[model samples]
Every structure is written in C-alpha cells, then in structure tokens.
Target: MGIIDAHHHVWDLSVRDQDWITGPQLAPLRRDFPLSDLEPQARAASVDRTILVQTITVPEETPELLALAAESDLVAGVVGWIDLTASDVAEKLGRLRALPGGEWLRGIRHQVQGEPDPWWLTRPEVLRGLRTVADAELVYEVVALPHQLPAAVSAARHLPELTFVLDHLGKPPIVSGQLKPWSAAVRELASQPNTVCKLSGMVTEADWHEWTVDALRPYADTVLDAFGPQRLMFGSDWPVCTLAAGYAEVVDATGVLLAGLSPDEQAAVWTDTAERVYGADRPNQCRIRRVSPRGDASLD
Candidate 1:
C-alpha cells in the first residue's frame, strides 16, 4: 500500500570529489546528481520515504547530510560516513550524536569496498568502531564488494548485537553473468539473524546498455530467499541506477518481480519493514488530492 526507499543518495558537486567515479567501470556516472533529481520521479512512482545514504566516506559529509535531511521532508532518515579508523573513533561518534539534526542520522558507513585489504572489517580497530554503532543504537550500512563478504560476515558476527543493512545486494556480478561465489557468500551473511539486504543498485552492476529485469532476478531472488520478506527492503538506487535505467524503470521492474508474492509479503518488502527497522514514518502516507492542479490539497 505504501513504500519506503530504504537506500538512496544525494551529493552536491561543489564540494569534495568522489574519486571512485573516474574509473572506466563507472564512466557512465560522471554527472552531478542531487536530491532534486530524485524528488519528482519518486513522487510519481509513490515511493514516499527515503533514507539519504552518504556518497563519500569523509567525516564532514555526515553533518552536511544531516543538515540536508532537516530541510527535506522526502529525506526520512540518513546513513552517514564516519572514519572508523581514527584513534578516537568512539569519542567522535558520541560527539556527532549531539550535533544539530543528529536525530535524522540513523546509521553509519565507511567505503569498505575501497579498502586495500580484504580483511579490513576484521581489523581490531575497525571492529571496535563497529561495536560503537551498536552501542549507540544505530544501524551499520555494509557497502562491500563480493570478495569482501567474508570479512563482513566476521565483523557482523563479532558485533552480533549491531544490526547491518547490506548495500547493493553484495555488488553481484550481473554484467559477467556469474553468481557462484557471490551468491554463496551472500547466503552466509544473510543466515545471520542481525543482517538484512537492500534490493538496490543492480542496474549499475548489470549490462547497462541492454539489461532487463530478468538479468537481475537471480541475484535479487537469492537475497529474498536468504533474508525473507520481512528483512528485505526495496530501494531505487535512483540517479546512480541511471547508469542503466531510469527511476520509473527500476521501480516498475522490481514491481514485476514482486508480482507473484502475496499482498502481505509485498507490503513488508515495499514499506512496513523499513519503517520498523529504521523507525521512520512512511512518506506521503496520508494526503488528499483535489480535482484540479490549482485546487486545494489537504491531509486525508
């Protein structure tokens, strides 16, 4: 009946550089995409609430996003960046909690996918910082490449009390059409009671120019099977997914795959699950429309 896009992003071009976008693997994503670009499309598709995920791994980016959240009703929550490797990591997190708009900050993330070490998450310092996330009552957004899944699993196990949201469906290999290692690894992570995966970002991983929903189904199915309906959440990776398809296509294609599921199960994947996990209100949940564009609008 309603939907909460559990994962999405917003970035201002005038600020710091996103160095990851320069590579050939991501050549198609070389433009400035901000919250405005996503607002109109999300409204049309009825994706009411969104978690504004951070695009950069710098400390300053978190506060900037928290400020943005305060100004935008569309932004129901925020997953922000924190340098977990710093010596005083615990203190930093506590300090951030007292900042303005901090209530909108519901989670923390680091670009672990960019780490040189495959076992980065298992490192003592990083694991210590991850524990702080659980201690502070926030979710941890696990954004890792396929190879890094094992370390993610280890970290997740060490901090069993800390809840995790897997980003990009483990960055599956849709473009090459292989699923063995990735699928198996994802199953292991999802087997844990504390982990959940977002059904987002497949467009960028698949054959961008000539991909279809069928191409991404196997990966999405694996995650759905492993995590079940209540733990799974839908996300239109939006402007980022534009590298392959538009906002409407991403939403429509996901709807097609979900067609066979029961109304109750579909409700959780689309809306209820996110609200329960993130403590966020569904966007546009109760609004009334008038006969004309110029006519009155009010709460139903």
Candidate 2:
C-alpha cells in the first residue's frame, strides 16, 4: 500500500541553532538533519510523499522549508510556522505564498505546547489569525500538550471553516499511563468535523528504552475510536521519532496498532486521509512515482 508520512521535520544546525535542543536528552537532535539524511530511510519504508513540518517558530524557517520542498522529490507538502497573533498575518501569508516553491505551503503551525498559557489558542488575536488562515484555504496544525487540548477544541468550534490537524495525539500522557482527561478531551476535539489527528510521536512519550506497541495501544485505540481512520493519519515524526525508535520501527508499530482495521480503513490511515486533509493533489502538487510492495512502479 502507498504511504504518506504526514508529519516529519528536517533542520540544518549550520544555518541556525535549535534553541529547544538544549538539555542532554535532546542532544542527539542538536546536529543538522537535512532532507538528504532522511530520504533513504523514508524510501526504505515505502513512504511515497511526506509533509515537511516546521521545528522552530521563526519567520525565516517557512520560506527555507518551502524552497527546500521546491527541490525535493519526496516532500509533497510543507506545514510551516507562522505568527498566528500577528496583526498583519494575512499579508505575511500572502508574501510567503509568493516566494519560491510557496505553492507547496499546505498548512501553518505554532508550538502551542510551549506556550505558558494553556488557553493560548483561544485568545482573540489568535482566533483572528486562524480565520485568516482559513480564508487562505490552509490547514492549521496544533502542536499542543494534553492540558492545552481544551483550548484547541474551543478554537476548532469557533472556526468551522478551518481544518485543525492535531499533531502527536496532543502529546498524550503515555509515560504516566493516565487516559481519563486526555481521552475525553480528544473525543471532544474529534467531535468537530473540521479536526483530524495524527498517529505519531508516541514512542518518545513512553519509556524510550522499554516502550512496546501494547504500551501505545491504549492511546492509539482511543483516537481510532474517537476520530475513526478517515480522520486519523499516520506520521513517522521522523528524526524526532529516532529518539525512541527507528523510522521502520515507528511504521511497524503503527501497523500493529492498526492491525484490527479492515484493509480500506488501514489505507485511509496510511495515505488517503493525509492526502485529503493536507490537500496533496497528486497531479498538481506531487509528482513522485509509487514503488509497489512487489517492486512494480506506477505514477502516484
């Protein structure tokens, strides 16, 4: 089956330092991770297309990602960072779209998880900026912590026109093994037709040295039941996922978590859902050829 990794990131440390990779735990990510480093691993896992997501919240990062996507065969879409609360956010988005390879800009994102205020997404100016994103026909990716999910749900309810893609299942409390508040909050977010969730980043949330597919099953099953496969997409969250598991391991673990679904349902999670949610139109946006499981080649 074809696969579209809906969330992955690449960074060049030589260009600028990643301020977040400060402590010993994140030291592995301090070095540069260009698309050249990721291409082979993704190809080995049969990932036909990928959505290149933003790592840091900087004005220059989006344009850089767009230009990189313009030259890549695997990066089909880009979910870049934007100042959601900027008064001139609309004009800024327009300018980004006009830059080289800007047509690949499918969505916008912010590190809402790092915000001191749990309700940051519900702020008035942020809401206005989100409306502008919708007006531009772009999706908004929410990288929020579990405590911030309520605000994410509130924002989704406030703007039905904008598609909200929840990254990493709102960073569930897998390590602690608690599911009550997170599960309930996820259900509420899925209740909004405009929202979708990514099945990713769970490995790092668990014990990096001892996490099993079963440990991730509870949280995975929670979203599967809440959002259904059509509203859930698979993402390697690569490079970051390498902190806990390899690229193939993440893909295999997700496969096991989704083993109970029908073939069609699995297909939705693997590729179709992402293509629809991220607007990855094969004819116009992506031109990568598909390599079948049995070594046959076909146009994507």
Global lDDT scores for all candidate models: 0.80, 0.87
lDDT string, candidate 1, 1-300, tens digits: 457898888766678777778878676677677888888889899987898888887788888888877788888888888888677767887777667767777888888898999999999988888877777767888999999999988887888777778998989999998999999999999877778778899988999899988998888888888887777889888778888889889999889878878898788789866776676763222111111111122222
Model 2 vs truth, CA RMSD: 5.8
Angstrom error of the Cα, residue 26, model 1: value is 4.1
* Worst window of 10 by summed lDDT in candidate 1: 286-295
Model 1 lDDT at residue 195: 80
Given candidate 2, what's the lDDT at residue 41?
A: 88
TM-score of 2: 0.93
The sequence of per-residue lDDT tens digits that candidate 2 reaches over residues 163-229 is 7889999999899899988999999998877788899999999988899999999999999998888
Clash totals for all models, in order?
0, 0
| Segments in model 2 whose C-alpha atoms lie over 4 Å from true places | 282-300
